[model samples]
Target: MKKLYLLLVAVLAIGTATMAQSKKALQTAVIKTPTVQCDMCKKRIEAFLDKEDGVASAVVDYKRKTTKVSFYTDRTNIENIKTAIANVGYDADDVTANEETYNRLPKCCKKPEDGGGMKKQ
Candidate 1:
């Protein structure tokens, strides 16, 4: 009985350590997409970020103008994610969209400042 108890404790300790380390390695960040105006913008950003290195997944909510991204800290970071979004032609947090990519985006995805994009609700 004592041997079984010790084994159980050892297993639990290993599980707890594994969970803690994985939690640190994986992180989720909510980034504001100030220029995200419609479904097209959401799809574009999500699709682009989904293929970025270390990004586990990306969810963009155009209505909220926010993007929630899951990534491995050891492989990438928040700054890289922001830049990835910018490269896709949408602003991420304080990072502005890449001007060339922005110009190439569809009319519905462009910022309202450009007299394009959907009207904000």
Candidate 2:
């Protein structure tokens, strides 16, 4: 019975540790995306961020030019999230979009400074 009690104590301790490790807090951050111009841009960024491993959800507001991202802090950090946004052809805070990706965006999605007309494509 002594051995059994010890086993039970070990099991409980292990279970508590596992639970604590898995209980990473979810965090949300708002990043400005100055270049996002239309619904298409919003959809693209949201879809891209949503597919990233740590991201829980992503919402882009074109009028305000911002993206709100919910993510697991244990799995990812804000810089990585911003880089992911840049990877999707949009600027996130100080991270610049990848040049090739930015160039490939539809003209309607590109910023006027990049020679993409703001007028309807």
Candidate 3:
């Protein structure tokens, strides 16, 4: 009985240590998207980012032209997140958007440099 009790205690201690090691804190980043022109741009970027691995949430403010992203650092990093954003036709900080993808964006979502893409309506 004593041996069994000691084995159970050891198992529990190991389990607790494993659980603690796996628990990672969510990190947040605010990335600038100077080309984000309107509501559509905001929604598109936020929705795409939310679907990425390790991303907990993403919110884009059209007025501010910034995206606030929360993600688990263990599964991904800031550079990966930014690259994902750029892949979806939106620039994240110093990362430039993919030209082919950016060209395919809706007229209102494109940057002014790409032929005056902002729509007032």
Going through the candidates in the order shown, the clash numbers are 0, 0, 0
| lDDT of each candidate versus the true structure | 0.90, 0.89, 0.87
Query: Taking the tens digit of each residue's C-alpha lDDT, what string does model 3 give over 7-73?
Result: 9999999999887765655788999988888888888888898889999989899789888999988
Choose the strongest candidate by lDDT: 1
Q: Model 1 compared with the native: what TM-score?
A: 0.80
Worst 10 residues of 3 by lDDT: 112-121
Candidate 1 lDDT, tens digit per residue, 16-121?
A: 9999987889999999998998888888888888789999999998889899999999999999999999999888888988999999988888877798878557
Off by over 4 Å in 3: 1-23
Pairs clashing within candidate 3: none
Compute each candidate's TM-score over C-alphas. Answer: 0.80, 0.79, 0.79
Rank ordering of all candidates by TM-score, starting from the highest: 1, 3, 2
